[model samples]
Target: MKFKITHVTTYLFDSEVFLEPHYLRFRPCQTSYVDVSDFITTIHPQPVGHKIVQDEDNNVVEFCWFEGMTTQLTIRAESVLQTKSYNPFNFLIYPQSFNTLPFQYNDLQKKLLFSALEQLPISKGLIDYALSILKRSNFNTISYLTNLIKHLHDDFSVEYRAEGAPFMPEETFQLKRGSCRDLSWMLIGILRQQGIAARFASGYYYFDMIAPAYELHAWVDVYLPGTGWFDLDPSHGIFTGNTHFPLASSAHYQHTMPVSGGIRGSANSKLNTQLIIKKL
Candidate 1:
């Protein structure tokens, strides 16, 4: 299937402000089951200089710089892409040890996935919450993840607050509901607590409905020894496949933001975002 997408982000400053260097991460990579046929972005008050480069996290990003002051900044991106259907479970976990709770990664794997495995302090209740799932899954790695996401999907409600950083994982777990990002982060915290390596992913999700609308979506990636980084969507209670197009992923959600930069002056700003995706 082919998809055409248009996404616009506008920042309206109440007062003139000097623009700073910014980075855009709207380019979804060409993967084994996905192809990027065409992609382009237009920026208003055209940037003075820009180049696409891979960041430390290895995300394909557009680094841009600007000149002069402006009251409004706009970025419009359009793209056409093709995605193929494939089974999300067409992989295997390696190192038999990793197939169970308290997974033990090989030395090299642990060294490389250090950040992804790091666990921030979570509330005791949340920790116990994850433990309950671990118990329910009988300590099986794959079953645990499947059960975790399913519980979140069936128990939690969805919210559409299109802006702001994701809620703290502990908060999301306590609240029992949140935006897609929040649920993903909540899953990340739970996995990390169980010694599983997980990270954040952001992109678009194609809904299986008539004339579906889409916004930026967030999910999680769990690293299994032989299978590499495995995709999991707690918000949707499934592993990802063709319908999920990931733009960028990082150990931290903030790093996956489509736009990253700052203004030079104290100009209060209002942010507005619009996204449209269609089957082509």
Candidate 2:
């Protein structure tokens, strides 16, 4: 499928600020599953300086600095692309050996991995609740993953909310709810805990049912042996495919914010966001 996406984020403040420096991770690269046919970005009042570079994890980054007093800031990004069908089971096996990387398995990673596994129906977490459904004897990783995705879709609700929430994996599992960013964080915590190198991806998604608009989105990717990193969307209940394009990725969301800066004055501020998407 092909789609055109428009994302607008605006921040309004009550008092002028001396300077603002921001990092943008809002551009997607053409990859095996998706193609970036056209793209553009516009920042209001212009910027003093900006540079595009690649980070340690290889994600694209755009850094910018704004000088002088300012009370409002706006950032807009648009894109056109095509996405492919997604199948999580197909990515169960890592294609290459990621063990050679500098990444090392630590105690925190192990604890998180074990915790995620235990929470699942197959593991020791909530076996009784899962047993009610497992008695049917029709279960596999593919099925389990699929069911888990759907379960999240049905049981949880998505909200724009704020970005101030502390990254807590245990709380999310207990609440069984959060925005895409929260879910992605939880998944990343689990993957990292398991000795799997995972990262948080922030981007835009075009969904037919949810108001044809592109909005800030988040997902998680797990490093497989041979295939590299495979994308997963617990909020969507499936693996992401070509339809998903990443702007920036990092070990956590705090590292890949689309726009971040400091305001000088103590002014009450409000933020508004709008996203529009359409099939091409």
Q: Provide the TM-score for each candidate, comma-separated.
A: 0.97, 0.76
* Candidates' C-alpha lDDT: 0.89, 0.65
How does model 2 score by TM-score? 0.76
Give one digit per residue, the lDDT tens place, for model 1 in 51-81: 9999989999999999999999999999899
| Model 2 residue-pair collision total | 12
Candidate 1's C-alpha lDDT?
A: 0.89
Model 2 agreement with the true structure over 1-280: per-residue lDDT tens digits: 8888887888887887665677777778667777788888898758889888786657777778877777888889888887776654564343223323323434654454342223211223433433333333254333434454566567667666555643466566667678788777766664444345667777776666754535678887665444556677878877886667777776656777777667677787888888777788
